[model samples]
Structures are given as C-alpha cells and as structure tokens.
Target chain A: MRGGSWRQSSLTGIGVLFGVTLAGLLLLPFFALAISTPASDLLEGATHPLFASALLLSLRTTLTSLSITVVLGTPLAWWLASSSSKTARVIEVLVGLPIVIPPAVVGVALLQTFGREGLLGPALGSVGIALPFTEISVVLAQIVVSAPFFVKAGASAFREVRPDMLIVARTLGASPPVAFFRVALPIALPGLLVGASLAWARALGEFGATLLFAGNMPGRTQTMPLAIFYALESDVRLAIVFSLVLAAVGMLLLVALRFLPALRNFMRGGNA
Target chain B: MTSWQVIVRARRGELDLDVTFEGDEQPIALVGPNGSGKTSVLRAIAGVLDLRDARITVGDTVLEDTSAGVRVPIEERRIGYVPQGFGLFPHLTVLENVEFGLSTGKNPLQSEERSRRALQMLSELNCASLSERSVKHLSGGEKQRIALARSLVLEPAFLLLDEPLAALDATLRRTLRQFLAERLRLFQGPSITVTHDVRDVAALGAQIVALENGRIVQQGPLSLIQQSPATEFLAEFVGAD
Candidate 1:
C-alpha cells in the first residue's frame, strides 16, 4: 500500500509536469506577442488601411457565414439529435467531412462546384453569375469549413435537452415548433452560443480556402488572415501587429464562452 | 368525471407491450418492475409514443385509434403528462413554465389572464411562493408540485403521472405522496400513475395494475391483488404469500 501510494503520487507529479509543459508551449507565443511590442505599434497597426479593410472584411464575411451556419445548421442539428436512423448517421458523417478535410482541398472543391467551368457553370452562366475570386466565395469557404463545428456542438447541445421535457411541453399544449422555441432552444442556447463562437473563430482565421477561392485583393476579399499573410512577405512587424489584434479578438470570444452559462442564468431571471 | 380507457400495443426495441385498462375518477396505480414498459404505457396514452395498434379514449373523445386512422397530435391530446422526475422547463421560472400551456394552444389567453390562471393553479398546488423562482433552484418536491401545477392548469381530460415521486428522498417521498394523493382527489380526473413502490400505491389509494415483461399480469384493487398475485413481481409488490 505504501509503494502504491508513492507510485500514485509520482504519477500525479508526472501528469502535472507534462500538462504545465504543454500549457507553457501553447501560451508563451501569446505572452511574447503581447510584451514584445509597445502599445503604440498595435495602435499604429489598427489605424493602417490594410488592417482596417481586412478587419472590416473579416467581420462582415464571418458574421454572414456564422448567421447562415446557425440558420441552416440548427434544424439539421436538431434532426440529428432527435433521430436514430441510419441516414441521419450518414449525413452526420458527411457534415463532419469538411472539418477534417484540408482547407486547400475544400477550396479546390468549391472552385470545381462554383468556378467558371465547374459543375454548376452552365446553370450559373445562364443566370449571369460568377463566383470565383469574390467576397461571397470567402463567405462560402468559411461556411463549408466552420459549419460542421457548430452542427456537431449544436446537436450534442440539443441532445442534452431531455426528450421528456419536449413531451411534457407538448402535453402542456405547446405545438412542436412552440416547444422547440420555448424549451429546446433556450435550454440549448449557451451550448449553441459556444458552438457559434467556435465557428466564428474558425471563420475569422480561415486562410487557405479564402486565399484560393477569394484572391488576395487589398480591400475586396482580403480578410485579416490573408492580410497577415500578405504583410508577412515584406513587413514582419505589421504581420505581428495583425496577429496580436486577431489574438485579442479571439481571446475576447474565449472569455465570452467562459461566461455564457452565467449570462444564460442571468437572462433566465437569475435562477442559478 | 371522465372515464378513461387506454389500449396500448407497442413494440420498442425488445419490449413488446400490450396492455388494456380503464378507470374513472380513481387514480390507477401501475406497479411494475424496471423495464416493464409502464412509462411507455403512459407515454402511449399521452400521445407522445406512436403505437403499432392502440386505442385511447376519455369518455366519447377518441384521443387515438390506429385502425380508425384517427391519431391526435401530442399538443391536441389534452392528456396532462407529468413524466418521471417532473420534466420542468429549466429555462423558465415556475410561473412561466405553468403559463406555457396557457400561452399557446387553440385558445390562448391574454398575458394577464395567463399569469392569473398560472398563479391560481400554483396556489391550488400550494406552490404559489415558487412562481417567480427559477425551476433550476427548485427542490425535488417543489419541482413535483410545480410540474403538477403546470399540467393541472390546463385541466386536461386525463392526467398521466410517471413515477411522480420517484426522484425524491424516502422521507420526502412519503410527504409528497400524501400531498399527491390529496391533489389527485382534488383533480377528480381519471388518472394513471406509474410506480415501483407498494407504499405509493397504498398512499394514493389507487387501483393496482401489476405489469410484468411489458404486459399486464394482474389488475384489481390492491386488496384483491394481494389475495391472488399472478406474477412473482406482483406477489412481491403486494407482499402476498
């Protein structure tokens, strides 16, 4: 027993050592990014035209993609959460494919589907529509890659809502949609918000797909990550500043995710 | 008093349940071991579970009749169901949870009217103090009462309770069972209650319908079932020789 206790203590010690090492490795870059530059450099970067256009474009495209993801992914997530069928399982796998597929491959696939000589080429040409090297393509790429995160998280969130609650809601005279809006949605709100935040973060940092599908235009389709890439070729300091700004935004989202539960409780009349 | 009849022929996974029972005013206690499909029976009656073949009627109103091609949607069933552990809406306050039904359905009341009715129902269930409180902060017994109020406010033709006191501690279970008995009396509607404890059956003064392997093995007054229990589960339940 004494030897076992000593072994257990050593195991715990080793676990903590490895955990701290990994955390340090992950956090050191961010800490360096903050302390390496004076605040004035960050301010200068924020005021730059490249920073302004990239920030605005990133915000616009990511918001649009996130909205579309929520609108389309929610029902699909709910269906997946409630269903126990083979088809739902297959579709869930299909939805998850983009998350693991390389972003450049996704860009190529998008090009093939919506490009000038692609599958929908003639149909789109008839309507006088072209999608390559556009802001809309950037939004499309973000949606394809980021929506799966929301759907995966959203489905699990909706599943956490007990089926019995919906049944009771129905018995209480709430229609199917009413029950969904009143009970399921509110119960799953915090989780859905977390998922949306993750998807938005992914969309904000999207690079390879945006680079291929939406060319590196200065103000039109150039998002923040693309701007950072372009800036890095000639101006490393500017790239660092852009990285710092993106890191700050991402950190804000992370902090918001941490407080979502408290916010939900507050909105529900401070019940918690 | 509405006379309620339930005929459930449902197969879910391995459980092939076929049960038929009827009651009026008196609360029917469905005592069965775990995995006996008692809750499934209640769900079938409540129109939440689709049955292979079933007929549920309260008085002359047919809630479901598969052969007749008449199956009412869950919201239109008007069979108040308080599922096991009392499935309260966690996002709503007690009053809002109770007011949910009143805010919807074919005849939705005004907001003031909804609150009034919800408060009245809460008062009837002796839970008026908890109206503004969040359902998340409610104790088990309080949740049971609030759930009852939420369902009873609608005044459905029948009430189906699935182990209404199953989630409470033993000491609280006794008190809540007594409370539930009184509430059932006041309700005066044909109701079915699923339970595992014989004490719950006696406390509620409910007629017993003992189930085994998803089928009704024996059913009668508790006194009668005690005299001649069919299955070993029923024998153990009634403490029969």
Candidate 2:
C-alpha cells in the first residue's frame, strides 16, 4: 500500500509539473507584457496623434480587406464545396499555399508579381495604374494575404452543409440562388464570421508584408503594427499602447463572434 | 387532377437503374432493400437526380422527356420532397422552416399569411407548440414532424418521402407511421414513399412496388405484394417466416 501511494504521489507530481510547464510556455509572455507596462503610460501613449492615425488606418484597411475577402471568398468556397472535379482540388491547394508560405516571402512575391516592373506591370502602367507604396496597396496586400483564411473556413463550413437540405429546398420551389442564400449562407454564417475575424486579425497585425509591399507611411499606409514598429524606434510607451489597443480590439471581436447565435449553436455541438 | 408517369434510366457506379411507374389516386410505397434505387426513383421524379433517359409528365405538364430534350428545373417541378434525414434547417425556427418554401417561391405568400399557414400546418402535425423553437433544439421526432409540415404546407402537386421513418426508433417509427398514414390520406394528391420496412407499408396502407437490383420486381395492393411476393428477394424483404 505504501509503495502504491508513493507511485501515485510521484505520478501526481509529474502531472502537475507537466501542466505548469505547459501553462508557463503558453502564458508567460502575455503575463510579462502585462506586468512590464504600466496602464497609465499605455493610455497616454495611445492618445498620441500618430498612434491614433495608425489605429484608424488599421481598422479601415482591415475592414476593407475583410469585405473583399467575404465577397470573393464565399462563392469560391461554395464552388469548392459542391464541385468534386480535379480542377477544384488544384484551386483549393493553390489557395492554401499562402498560409504555409512565410509572410515575408508572400510580401516579396506580391511585389514581384504586382510591382511596377513585374508581370502585368506594363499593361497596368500603360493604364497609369500604380500599386506599390500606396494606401490601396496596403488594402490589396491585406486581401491577398488574409483571403485564404476566410476561404478555407468558409469552404469547410459549406462542405459540412447537407446536400439534401438544398435538394429539399429546390423541390419545395426555391430557386438555386434563393436556396443558397436562405439555407446555405445562414448555415455557414458562423464559420464565415470566424474566418472573417481571423483574416481581419491577421490583416490588422500585418507588418512584414505591409512594410515590403505598401511601405510604412504615417497617416497613409501605416497600420497599428507598423506604427508600433515605428514608435518602438522612438518611444517605447507608444508601442505598448498600440499593442494594448490592438489586443483589446481583437478580444472585443472574439467576444462578439462568440455571441452570434449560429456560432453559439456550433460551439454547443449542434449541426446546422 | 394531377397524374404522373415517370421513366428513369441511370448508371451509378456499378448499379444501373432502369425503371418506370405511374400514379393516380393511390399512395405508392417503393419498397426495397438498401441500394435498390428507391431513393433514386424518388429523386428522379422530384427532378433532383439527373438521368440520361428520363420522361416525366404531371397532368398536362411535360416535366421531363430526354428523348424530346425537355427537362424541368427542380424549382419549377412543383413537387415536394422529404429526404431520408428529414433535412430540417437547424439554423431556423420550426415556423421559419415551414415558411421557407412559401417565402422564396415564384408566387410567394405574404409573410403574415405564410406564418398563419405554417402555424396551421404545425397544428395539423400536433407540433404547434414548437413553432418558435429552433430546429436544432427539437427532438428527432419533432424535427421529422416539422420537416413533414414544411413539405406539406406548400400543397404541391405531388409529395415524396425517402425512408420517412428510417431515422426514428421502433416505437417512434410505429407512431409516426400511423400519423403519416392519416396525413397522407388527407393530402388529396399523389404521394410516393420509399422505405425498406415492410411494417411501414402495412401501417401506412400504401400500394407496394417492390424493387430488387434497380428493377421493379412486383407491384400491386399491399396484401398482394405481401401474399404473393413475386421474387425471393421480395419474400426476404417482407420477412417471410
């Protein structure tokens, strides 16, 4: 009995040790950041004009990127879900490639493809269109880098939809478009929203690609992350403030997403 | 009076289905074993399944005739189908699911009127208490009732149910079979039910069309199919003792 108790105690000790180490690795940096930065200084730095502009720019660009992602991604996702052709698989793999590629490389590749001297550059230049180092370029960069997230989530959600539901709708006198919008879209909304939120967060925090493609310009193209980088070069307090604000917004979005009835149903393991 | 005759031919992998049937006053039950093309027959009649050579006519309407190169879209077929799983829209409330077909159709009923109609349908199915409840919250039996109400509220020319009680427990299946028989009797239109359960044929009091290997082996009154059972497969299907 004593030996069994000793072994049990040792097992308990091992469990606690593993749990603590895992928790520390996962949470230590966040705790350190919270501890290191004083709330008062963070607030003061956040109110600075340049930081304010960056925050606004980040919100605007990320929202625009999100809108574009939803519009284009939803149909593509739906198509991918319904089609079993080899071409659809190829397109799915192509869309997923962005997620695995390093963000910095994605940035460089975007520049090489859409830059002034790149492919389609001559045609675009002839039309007097310039993409690099502009605010629009920032939006474009965010879209290209963030859209795959929305597409992937939206496709999975669409795939989860029962084909019989759509067939029932059609037999009940619903046109294809009406059935898709009324039945499929509502069912897939939670996943689509989650995808949008993820893409928005990624776009909001975008630094490497934005810097490479859009070029950090204050009040023009400088997003919150870019501002944080610039502020850290001069004022550390402002960087902390920007980081806090971004974190707060992200948290708020997550809370809002959780409140959606569709998402809530999904979380509770209810099928759509 | 809406009357229909349908002939469909299709090859799904190794299974080739070539079948023909007609309907008038009687409610038909396509009784068959698994993969015997019962659901495919209903799907073809509903215009949900694409067939290489198919001809379908409902009253004066020529819905589909591949030989004549005419095929009606599913939305235009004016047929109601309840798939095997009941396929309730989990995101919508019971009332909303019933109202869906009416709201999106060519000649859409007004929302208020549609709600009233839906409520009446729920009442018919003894599920009026579940109107405001989300479909996801409904029990399996309640969901099936709502799916039936949703399909029936449209008052289509014909109705199709694929394995209507296949998802229910034995007790629920018996209860629902009785309820469905009563409802089908009052429908005032041709109806087709696909099921493997011989008990459903008796309970629903439907004409039995037994199928084996995608071909109609025998079809007549339920008693005839049960008593004679043209093929050995039909005898096995009827669970001959």
Candidate 3:
C-alpha cells in the first residue's frame, strides 16, 4: 500500500510540475514585455500618427479580408462539409493549401499570379488596372494567406449543423437558399464567428506575404506588424510599445468574444 | 383531401424495402422493430431521401415518379416533416421557429398575418407561453409541441412525423401522443407516423401498418391489426401473443 501510494502521488507531482512549467513558459515572454514597457508608453505609441495609421490600416484590411472570406467561404464551407464527393474533398484541400504552405511561398505565388507581366497582368492591364503595391494588394495578400484558416474553421462549424434541420426547413416551404440563410446560417453563426475571428487575427498579423506582394508603403500597405518591424530597425522602444499595443488589442477582442451570449450558449450546447 | 400514396422501393444498407400504401386523410402508424426501414418509408415520402422505383403521388399530381424522371424538390412538395430529433431551430425563439414556415418567400401571407397565424397556432397548442423562449431552453415535450405548431402552421398537405414522442419521458409521451391525435384532426392531410409502441398506435393512429424485414406484414384499422395479428412478428408487435 505504501509503495503504490507513493508511486501514485509521485506521478501526480510530476504532472503538476510539467503543467505549471508549460504555463510559465507560455506566459514568460508576455510577462517580460509587459514589465519592460510602461503602460503610458503603450498608450502614447498607440496614438502616434505613424503607428495609428498602421493600426487603422491593419484593422481596415483585415476586416475587409474577413468580410470577403465570409461571403465567399460560407458556401464553400457548407459544400465541403455536406458533400460526399471526391471532387469536393479535392476542392477542400485546394482551398486549404495556404494553411500548410509557407506564407512566403504564398506571397511569391500571389505576386506571380497578379504582378506586372504575370499570368493575369496582361488581362488586367487591358482593363487599365494595377493591383501590386496598393492597399488592394495588402488585402489580397492577407486573404491569400489567411482564407484557408477561415475556410477550415468555417467547414468545421458547418459540419456541426444537423442536415435534418435543413431538410425540415425545406418541407416548411423554404427553398435551398432560403433554408440556408434563414436556418443553417443562424445556427452555425457561432462557429462561423469563431472562424471569422481567427481569420481576422491572422490577417491582422500577416507580415511575410504582405511584405513580398504589397511592398510596405506607409499609410497604405504598412500594417501594425510591418510597422513594428520597421520601428524595431530604428527604435527598439517604439517597436516594443507597438507590439504591446497589438497584443492588448488582440486580448481585448478575445475577452469580448467570450461575453457574446449567443456564442456562449452555442458553444455550451455543442460541448454537451 | 391530400392522401399519401407512395410505392417505395429502397435499399438502405442491407435492408431492401419495397412497400406500397395509398390512403386518405387518416393518420397511418408504421409500427415495427428497429432496422425495419419504417423511418426510411416516411423519409421517402418527405423527399428527404432518394428511393429507387418510387412512385409518390399527392392527389393526382406526381410528386416523384422515378420511372418517369419526375421528382419534386422538398420545398415545392407540401410536406410537414418532424424529424426524429424534433429538429427545432436551436438559435431561434419558439415564435420565430413557428414564424419561419409562414415567412417563406413562397408563402402568400404577409409578415404581420404570418406572425398572427403563428401565434394563434402556438396559443392553440397551449405553447404560446413558451413562444418567446429559446428552443434550447425548452423541455422535450415543449419542443415537440413547438415543432408540431411550426409544422401545422404551414397547413401542409401531408405530415411526416418520425417517432414524434420517442425522445420524451414516458409520462410526457402519453400526454403528447393524445395531444398529437387531437391536433392532427384539424390537419386536412393524413400523417404518416413511425413508432415502435402499440400505445402510440392506439393514441395517434386511425390506421396501422405493420412492417417486418422491410415489407408490410399487415395493415388495417388499429383494432383490426391488434385483434387479428397476421404473423408471429405482428402478434408480438401488437402484444396479442
């Protein structure tokens, strides 16, 4: 009994030690940054014109990319989740490629596809359009790198929906589109919201692709992350402050997400 | 009156079902052991399932004639389907769930009238008090009532209820079975209900069809089927042995 009890307690002790160690490891960098940078500096850097525009530009482009992804990804997600076809599986993988590929590879691919003398460049030129090194390119780059995450998460959300409910909706006189919008979309909103948040965060922090595809132009393509990179080269304190501000914004959004009652209920029910 | 006339030939997994029944506005009870394709029969009529050699007609209109390549889509087919799980919209209030059927683009009723009609249906079912409640907050019996109210508000040409009260507690099942029979009388169309209980047959059915091994073993009025069991399975099913 003594040996057994000692072994059991020792195993539990080891588990606790590992758990606390992992938690401390995860929080160490954040803790260090918080103590190193004063809150007053964070507030000041957040409001400065250069940092402020970058923050505004990041929010604008990410929100735009997220909106575009939601509008396009929802149907794609529903189809991927519901279909039993091999072709659907192939399409899902194609759509999901960005999540596995290096962001730099995606940037190079995007530039090749849309840059001057690239595949669609001649066609775009005929219509008097240039896409590279602009805010549009920034949004496009973010989308190319981040849409796969949204699609993957969105597909998972759609998978949780019961197909029978949609069938019942159809029998209640709702056509396929009507049933999808009025029934499926509402029930899957929480999952879709989670997906949107993930995609939004990913788009907000995108660096490698935007740097390659959308050259970091201040007041345009230069987002918060890009701003932090440039700030670090010239002034270490400025970079630290900007990084703290971005982390704070992200934390605030995550806190707000938990408080949304509908999502909370859906998530709770889902677990049950 | 809208009648459910379907000759369904289907193969689900290993179960090969070839069953035909044609009748008027009387609730038909499909009683059988599990895996007898009872639910498949109801699903076939609801157009939520694809069946080989199925000829489904509502009155004279051919809803699905697989031979002639005529299959009506689910929305166009006027079927009120209550799935096995009740399939209520969890995110919606009971009133909104009921209002959903009436607010369809194909529904002629305006938004105001649709709301009024949905409320009246809820009130009739004694579920008006629960109308503002989210469906996730509802008890099984309450959700069942709301589901029925939602289905009935459509004034559907036919009702397809898959083991309606199976999810409820025994006490609630008995109460809701009687409640369903009373409510179904107001519906002009016949309902095809799938059940494993003989009491469900007595409370909710005017006609009963016994299925075994994916085929109808016997069918008639509930009393007739119960009194004169056609096979050992029928006798066992109706508790006559």
**Candidate of highest lDDT:** 1
Note the B-chain TM-score for every model.
Answer: 0.96, 0.95, 0.93
* Candidate 3 structure quality by residue, lDDT tens digits, A85-179: 99999999899888888888988988889998889988998999999899999999999878888888888888877988998888888888888
Say what the interface RMSD of candidate 3 is.
3.6
- On the 0 to 100 scale, the lDDT of residue A69 in model 1 is 99
DockQ for each candidate?
0.76, 0.61, 0.53
**Candidate 1 interface RMSD to the true structure:** 1.1
Interface RMSD of each: 1.1, 3.0, 3.6
Candidate 3, residue B201: the lDDT equals: 77
Which candidate has the top score in DockQ? 1
Residue pairs with backbone overlap in model 2: none
Candidate 1 per-residue lDDT, tens place, B1-241, comes to 6787888899988999999888888889988889998888888888878799999999999989999999999999888899987999887889999999999888899999999999999998888988889888889999999989988899988888998988999899889999999989888888899988888889889999888888888888899988888888888877832
